[model samples]
Target: MMLSHYLIVSGILFSIGFLGVLLRKNTLVVLMSLELMLNAVNLLFVAFSRYNLSLDGSIFVFFSITVAAAEVAVGLAIVVALFRLKQTVFVDAFNEMKN
Candidate 1:
């Protein structure tokens, strides 16, 4: 696919992920949206790397994936802790921590 095509796809995926994050009430869905957004970014990076015929963007994508993996690990830990304390996966239930 061309760079523009990849960019469009990435944009759409990012928007969908943004909507999911904003509209979903469940904590798990929110986390998944974040992952989707990350993947979209990775796609964009790879596409640009191919377009430029350079390893820079691809190398960054690799680092991004690694960071994303770490993010998932920590995010899931927080989610598990929240579920244990609240007994529900709803985002609203986490509001008490705002203080």
Candidate 2:
């Protein structure tokens, strides 16, 4: 596969994730969308690494994956806590943070 092919796929994935984040009302779906976007970036990093025959991009991807995993963990924890508090996972339902 060519670099352009990888880039095109990454762009499509990013666009889908962006749309999901903007249009989805559910917190869990939004989080998943965010993860999708992160993965798209990771794909780009790996692709460039391969194209350039370098290890730096791959190293960056490793860190990106680590950070993404941490993000998912924290995001899910927040979502679960919010659900327990309000019994709902809709983004709009979280407009007010005060008791």
Best by the lDDT measure: 2
Q: Show where candidate 2 strays beyond 4 Å.
A: 97-99
Question: What is candidate 2's lDDT per residue for 10-32, written digit by digit as tens?
Answer: 99999999999999999999999
Error of model 2, residue 65, in angstroms: 0.7
In order of appearance, the predictions have TM-scores of 0.94, 0.94
For model 1 the local lDDT of residue 75 reads: 94
Candidate 2, backbone clash total: 0
